[model samples]
Target: MAGLGGTKMKNTWQQVKKVGIVHRLLSFWSRDWFLKVVSIWLAIVLWVLVGGEDTIEKTVNVPVEIINLPRGLVVSNQYKKKIEVSLTGPRSVILDMDDRNIVRQVDLSKATPGTMVVNNDVDHIDVPRSLTVQRVQPPSIILSIDKLVQKQYAVVANTVGDVAPGFEVKSIRMNPEYVMITGPGSVLSQLSALQTSYISLDGFRRSEQLQVPLDLSPAIVSLIGETSVTADIVVGLVVAVKTVELPLVVQEKGLSLLPKTVSVTASFPQILLDKGKKAKDLLVAHAERYGQTDQFNVIVTSQNNEEFPVKVISVLPRRVSEGKAKLLRATTKKKSE
Candidate 1:
């Protein structure tokens, strides 16, 4: 039983917006390059020292971008997403700055697949000499690197809360059934199947369709193509009904039943009715032993059947003639096994 359960960009890929590696790069530069170049150019020109201006300190957050990382390796640890730089510069120059285009670049040209720490310096910021670097919030970065690998794993739907009160999750279907991901091999090896983030079943009484992201650890892995999947969850009743024919017998007062078989219909808990369970395995029928003479009503119960409870909904041929064919007595012949 289960019950219910940011759009931001960083140094890591934006999951929802990233279509693929090639498409993302092309679209990013094409859409953003012109504005970025113009902003930097204007900021540089205007940054020339103003003779009599007062200097002030300002802090800005700059996005971090990783470059030149080898294709065979991936960073496995959480690194700085943004560098917070506090700069002291002329008031006029600082006010004219558009830091949106400013990015802190981290180069991995000489990097290998292992744990490493790198220092973040004030020089990484591209401000003119008029601005002096006062401080950087995080002076150093630590990262774990591992061999990059690709794998495909089956997808599972996840949910929280019980579906209504008398309902069950009959089945779960994923549109693509599986997911392919590119990530660090050490982390990928620990996973067998990818699971979607939890969806709510709180008071939900019927099937529904949902779009959910995979439950993945940050910085350790990245989805290859589709970032989220379509999930179809089926809900159904908790009880099941079945009809079966079983031999009816009499065990008390030395009496017998004439038509010694019956068609019995029963309702059973769906939780206990898997492939190995059957009507005969959970029900027994016999002629009633009480409250009648020469004629008895058929009694059905699941008494000796694994202590599981069953309800008799309908029993065809509800009564039988006793001691005759006309009321012919049922007989048992003893023999050697």
Candidate 2:
């Protein structure tokens, strides 16, 4: 009975050891264990799909960006602002990218005026980590850079409505006469004329200076100094005109006059006529010393006793002829007499 009892103990110990081994083996196949194995397998599968040998080559249009240009420098030529990028990477990564995800940037912080070719390098492009840049469609870009410059342009007053009745706008003058502007060279070349803010002369009767803003489009140009300019509107009493016939002195020997005598109308300040500066004398003097163009005009003295200003009001025949055959017959007859 003792031996049989010992044998039973041994058999129980063996069975217990066998059961423990079986439990250990079954624990390896539990739900948590299966989950861990599946996670590792999925990680390998994802690696193969995203970073592995299954790569796709595709061409996508990416925006070309210019950054950090030096002060007073600009791109002056029309160029392709976009580029095509050929990418080689996992299918999942390459197909999911759009223009927003990738870009080719050119830095012009140290660029100077001239033509330059910029190469597309990996460092200049931004792309996803999983994708490889096979090539850039343009491979390079050509840029024409120029220095921004300042220019002066005459400003013309744009007026609305006429001066008050019986009071004429004698003269309009700008204080500065010109405006200084700064812009890109190409843009400045297109701008040859400039205008001022609309001024209304409807009921104006007095000589006054007005502060008017310069009408400039801010998109392409910038004002250098003052944006507002002074417009001098001179108004005076309108003088009635007296008409007279005056002989023109031919400045050039071979010059011909269209008409022997020109009808001249003079509008002078009442005080000048009161002081014995007759309209006939002033008109004859003006016709005698008319030096600028072939046409003669009616002029008023800018100031007291000064030479007549070159303000041309009107001329009858708008043109002059060359050659002695068309010279004035009256002048010839007077010379002969």
Candidate 3:
């Protein structure tokens, strides 16, 4: 029995030893160079799937030199003369660059009096290892400068308001219409003709007094600190007056009229009656001759009485040859009230 027990234990020990040997052989195969290389390649593929390349866009202000500036040309208000630029590329490259590495410039030497065209030559930007220039904000610019001759005109004051009803404007008066202005000879020659201050009252109702500021069209620097003309406008309302004419006619009611010539007469206020008295003054009038007549009456009506007081006065030629009398002349009375 003891011998059999020892045989059984030996067989178990042999099986355990075979298992250990198999494990050692598997470990050796796993540590092989070719297998180790394959595992590293798989790890790299997984890393690429999880992490991607970084791309970013950035904006920067690039400094530039203006070449070929024209003689006698001066640039005013050139504080922000740098060009605005935008760049896009790999994140690493863009983050490594600074604004000083970029260059911007405008050539004024070849410029003219008018708008000078700016060139879009942007080859001066020193980009980082991986970044490149994308675009510039203002591709070009026009440098406006003072020419030889320049002229300035005074600014006029325009009113806008409403006045009381039943009144009209009598007259409008302005203090000064023009001012003296001198600048570059070239600019002055172009501005040979000057315009007086123009007052515009598009929708004015009430009386108004305003001190308006003057503005120069196409603002020029030469007119700075120059003397400007001041103006005062007077607006008033007056009564409205109207003129009318009555024709000379003959009419009679209870008289057996005979054949005879008749005359006519008219009367009115000096201002109303005096207007167009002669052919030169008479804007329009009409009269017809008739025989002897009776029953004569002159009729008059008011046209516009809002401002001026108006009324009929007297008439001439009270009777005619026929039963009807001819209307000679009629008159109207006018007062300021």
Candidate 4:
């Protein structure tokens, strides 16, 4: 009972204080009814006029971002990456604006192949709500949309300059013979094959493995996945023709060549010829291989029959008499002494 009594007394005292405060407020307002109202309204009007006059206008560049782009579509033509915006707001707000975070987004979800003009609007810009966007520069932007194309192209290897003087390229090969590329249809449709950057073969004497890059302009097109490919170049010594006379040989007892020696033109690797090798040491002319003593074809072969050793190009007076065939053996034997 004692606690309840104390609580009632505290509530009565709080109510009395509240009533007294309200009575004084009413009395103060009643004292200057019309004049006080005018003064309060005038103060508000002055604050509004001063604040509106203190606003400033500023121009800023906001990066443009493409959003909601449809599938199988690409922006073919070059377009502005950023848009310029002019904004006006309270001086304090403009000075404290986070301009770096401002961005203008252009939506392309409804775009298709061809040219499209999208009008720039303040709604596209993201700025502080307290700041007002007065105007956006570049009333509109033009976009060229193209169908995204994907294709597989054969990789053609290209080489520039010559191999070493005595060397030649046997074959040029690429590891990935074909590549898949995705790009705008405008360019990809006109191209048939993709070529690699020209590989230099200057003074190259042996087979080599090289990293070759593709010939692609990033501004126009792009390769899928791989930027470069492995190149396998097969190099070999150049084959050269060498002409020399060799003594004709016949094993048959009844025949010999009319001319004791025959001019033989044969092909050899440049390295072999550089060694100053004698024709007789590298090759032999046998008339018996044809099994005919009269008017037989001159068969020339390597002495040791080595690999890629020799290739006969021509033989002067390729035929011989049956009786002359016997003289060839005698001439060779006589030279042996």
Which candidate's lDDT is highest? 4
TM-score of each: 0.47, 0.42, 0.34, 0.59
Question: Ten residues in a row with the worst lDDT in model 3?
Answer: 324-333
CA-RMSD of model 2: 17.7
Using TM-score as the measure, what is the rank order of every candidate, best first? 4, 1, 2, 3
lDDT of 4 by residue, 1-337 (tens): 9999999999999999999999999998989789999999999988886655587898888778889989989987778888788888778767766644777788899998999998888887778776788888787889989998888888899899998776789998898998877778986888788789899988898899999988876653433543788899999867777788887887766555677678988877766667786655788887654554356666677864454467788988686666554566777789997
Clashes of each: 9, 0, 53, 7
**Alpha-carbon lDDT, every model:** 0.75, 0.70, 0.49, 0.79
For model 3 the local lDDT of residue 315 reads 29
Q: Which stretches of candidate 2 lie over 4 Å from their true place?
A: 1-57, 99-101, 156-179, 185-192, 195-240, 243-337
Preferred candidate (TM-score higher): 2 or 4: 4
Q: Which ten residues in a row have the lowest lDDT in candidate 4?
A: 217-226
Report lDDT (Cα) of residue 81, candidate 3.
Answer: 68
Off by over 4 Å in 3: 1-56, 61-84, 88-103, 124-134, 137-148, 157-208, 213-231, 236-337
Residue 35 local lDDT, model 3: 81
lDDT of 3 by residue, 258-285 (tens): 2232222332223434443231132212
lDDT of 1 by residue, 1-337 (tens): 1222122334235554465766878877898798988998877766654555688988888788888898798887767799888888889778766734777788888899888887888888777777788888799888887898989999888888888765688888997897777778888898898788888888877789888887766543443543688989898657788888978877766655667689988877665675456657778888874465666778887853443467889998888766553324222332321
| lDDT tens digits, residue span 1-337, model 2 | 9999999999999999999999987887665887888899999988876557577798888888899999989887767888877888877667678535577778898899999899987556788777778778677889989888989888888889987655678899987788666767877787886778899998886888999987766644333533778999998756656665665555546545555556655565554565576665665422332465445433232333432222225555434343233356666878999
